[model samples]
Target: MKTHPAAHEPGHSSAPLTGFSQCHLGILSQLQAFEELPALQAAAAQAQTIATHTLALFHDAVYEHHADEERELFPAVLRSARRGEEADFAEAMVRRLTAEHRHIEALWKKLEPAVKAVAKARPVELDLGAVEELVRNYAAHARFEEEHFLPLAETVLRRNGNHMEALGLSLHLRHTPQPIGHI
Candidate 1:
């Protein structure tokens, strides 16, 4: 994998945030694309491409992105926050965001089989209402983290370079491939 120069540097990486933006935008774009099409038959090249893209996104990147935030970013913020109000706020934010992740994921679980069929260019039973609900929930979740949690995390981590470095490195390492274990 190509590594960014700042991937392990303090205050230099916003990989998690960037990941969130890309995944959400891609998901929303694919869902909206469906709305524009009269029907996404397996026969249409564009429909097939979009369906495949949507399936891969929801199946993989979204889950990994959520895991990255929960495992790396949230802990870093919590570690950096001062005791009392700052710590409490950080904890609360993490709890809310984590819950959001579960809720969104549950929505996806219900919707994934349809997405899978689309990706395979098989007969699809895509439900427009479920798609719309996922779109709305993801948008709101992204907004909350962007407007509230991210700024707070920045404030908490900015005071300590060590904390930022650790967070950055953890994020980088999470994406890095490891050597194969014994078969």
Candidate 2:
């Protein structure tokens, strides 16, 4: 698949933004695989393997990515907007994205246990419809962030001249693993 031009640009600051886009692409691929694969009832072992890998991808990357945006990026954008010139528009975008995050989290809760069971090779009735809904919602959410939110954030952060560093730092810290005893 062709990567976005922004993804190849030479800049450490853009790494997290590009990574987010790449992550979404990966997630969409996984979702498409899930949607296309035969039901778990038909091929238990293969389905179980796919389920386990997909669940791991979500837990390790997607969930943490969302948390980075919520805990670091969004707040930084809001603060820059509030203090800078784009207060109202940026605030509205942040609110919309945050609400979308909650919706995505709720759908994830509904799907997690079933995925976990399937991953364990246990016989559980999977809600394919809910899975499809989540895929649809997440695709839309990612699109919105990629096309709208991230650009807005970049603009606001750049205009403020300091928030971008903080955004980058927060993203780095979120993705970095802390020592087990450090909490």
Candidate 3:
């Protein structure tokens, strides 16, 4: 797939979100796999392998993605909007999206213990419902961001002083060899 020319640079032409978009694909696929896990299996070494990797992904990529959006992307978006109505609109979108993130995280928390047990090659009563819910909600959240928020962000950032460069710089600095997601 030919990515956007700026995909290699943080925040350049939605590069931050471009990477996020890819992560979303992985997350969804993993969630689907989790949904299909043999719930009653006594011992499945392969399940343990998948579970370990899934736990790593949730802890690393998904958590960092939330922090980046909350600390960087959403704020940059709010800054990119004009005062009054535009700002209000951006705030509403951010609120909804942030809420979705929290809800997804909550769903993950519910599933974490069971997944952890599976990771250790132990029997687990994995809540397939929770896994399915996470998959469903996350899918909707990603779709909304891709379909609505990203385009709106690009337009607003481009319109308001061409702030994409500043956002890019901010994101690049955040990911440099340092404590990430630290104030």
Candidate 4:
């Protein structure tokens, strides 16, 4: 895959969100692999490994993707767009994306306990339903982001040009560890 300049830089705080959105979609694709029958049996063992790596990519991409929008991108565009309805429209889109993230987090919390129980059993047959739920929620969240959020960001946020690259680098610098969501 070709690398976006903003995605690779550590100090660029102006990159448009498409850099992070595409990065997030990549992580989502890897999460789907855990749902496959061949991979499901190993999901528990792979949980820590996948979760650690995914969280790293996710923090730099998804978490900051929203933050950049709420803090910088949306505000930047909202200034020039219509003062009332268009502003509200951008805010509404941000709220929707934020809500989806919360929804996915909620499901992840529920799924964690179930995953823990299976982890205690190790190689034993785990609850496929629990795993399915997490995967489903994450997949849906990704679709929502791609279909709704990215379009608005591309249209509204990309107008600033090269700044997005700087923003992407700054976000990449903030990556950190995340706890596994309880089943």
Candidate 5:
């Protein structure tokens, strides 16, 4: 009977980037209050399924985001940056993000086995604490991008009015499943 807001509301400006962020937020909120719902422990265990999906979504998103920056955004901003401390700061961010993506990928690789086991209802399982930690870290990463990286792209790297829209559509199309019978 419970449904997401979007499920009930039609004609919304739906996009997967925001959708995934909201999904993670919903999952995290559920996990935070999990102790209060002992009867829903079985449902909580379904978080293993959510975790697997989250990892795949992030894997695709981050790879595309990094590629977008490397291919278009970063070079544009680098040219506009004041050629000293500001440029250095942007470079630092690029380095930090590149390293962070690798770290996140490594963490997800470790998490995959645990999630698979949980999905199978096997005795092997992910530590709730570790999963929470990973989620929190990713939340911070998303916040940084939304707060800092996106603004930079909008102001400094935007060459055309439609570049961001084009990028958004490209990312949204990735991983979207096609109907099997659609000709």
Candidate 6:
């Protein structure tokens, strides 16, 4: 239930590139912590505290980051690609990235309950193999986005001008929390 600093910030108006870079750093740190879990020998309360923080980081930040790409940026990229030499290239990349998202989500599902148990200070067996796989998968995912998807996005969005801003705005709106009474 902790608030993330990046949570309600206006993403499009702000620097999306910097935001993504920061997000990637945060995710890498959290994944490092996750990787360390198997080796941790803390008391129940300490373990629970660590797990709770990890869960919050994933839920609040990492997931939102993913949504920004999937919901806003990816669509913009597709539209921008509709009439370029990069058209087919963009399509293929988006498909690969989307599939990677699914793989990442599936890995999280396998990992969540064990993390939840740790959060509650309950004894639970974690799948170490799954943990290793998730860590490796995320590392690869980050690299792919940073090296491939991002450069392409920058090129396409740059040509489209305001599309980048629109993407930023969409990301900002998506992260902004809705009032409880709002429809």
Cα deviation of 120, candidate 6, in Å: 1.3
Q: What TM-score goes with each of the models?
A: 0.73, 0.68, 0.71, 0.49, 0.55, 0.70
Instruction: For residues 1-183, write the lDDT of model 3, one tens digit per residue.
Output: 797666577656666778999999999999998876776353487788889998998998998999999999999999878899888988999999999989999999989999999898777799888889999999999999999899889988888564888888888998888756967
Q: What's the candidate order when arranged by decreasing TM-score?
A: 1, 3, 6, 2, 5, 4
**Cα-based lDDT for every prediction:** 0.88, 0.84, 0.88, 0.64, 0.69, 0.85
**Per-residue lDDT of candidate 4, residues 105-167 (tens digit):** 676566555454554544344467866886787788679777965676666656666555545
In TM-score terms, candidate 6 sits at 0.70
Runs in model 1 deviating more than 4 A are 1-43, 181-183
Winning model by TM-score: 1
- Report RMSD (Å) for each prediction in the order shown: 26.9, 25.8, 26.6, 27.8, 23.1, 26.2
Positional deviation of 69 in candidate 2, in angstroms?
A: 0.8
Across residues 1-183, which tens digit of lDDT does each residue of candidate 1 receive?
988777778878687889999999999999899886765443466666877887789768999999999989998898889999989989998999999999999998998888777766777778999999999999999999999999999999989888888888889988889989896
Please tell me which model should have the higher TM-score, number 2 or number 5. Answer: 2
lDDT of 6 at 173: 79
Point out the higher-scoring one by TM-score: 1 or 4. 1
lDDT, residue 98, model 1: 98
Least accurate 10 contiguous residues by lDDT in model 5: 166-175
lDDT of 5 by residue, 2-97 (tens): 768775677766586699999999999989898678756766677667756665675677666667666556665666656677778777776776
Q: Give the TM-score of candidate 3.
A: 0.71
Pick by TM-score: 5 or 6, better one = 6
Better of 3 and 6 by TM-score: 3
- Model 5 lDDT on a 0 to 1 scale: 0.69
* Model 3, position 74: C-alpha lDDT score: 94
> How many pairs collide in each candidate, listed in order?
0, 0, 0, 21, 0, 2
Which residue pairs collide, candidate 3?
none
lDDT of 2 by residue, 1-183 (tens): 998886677773776778999999999999998986667456887888889987987888788877888788888888887554577778888788888888988998898999999899887998989999999999999999999888888877898666898788878877678888754
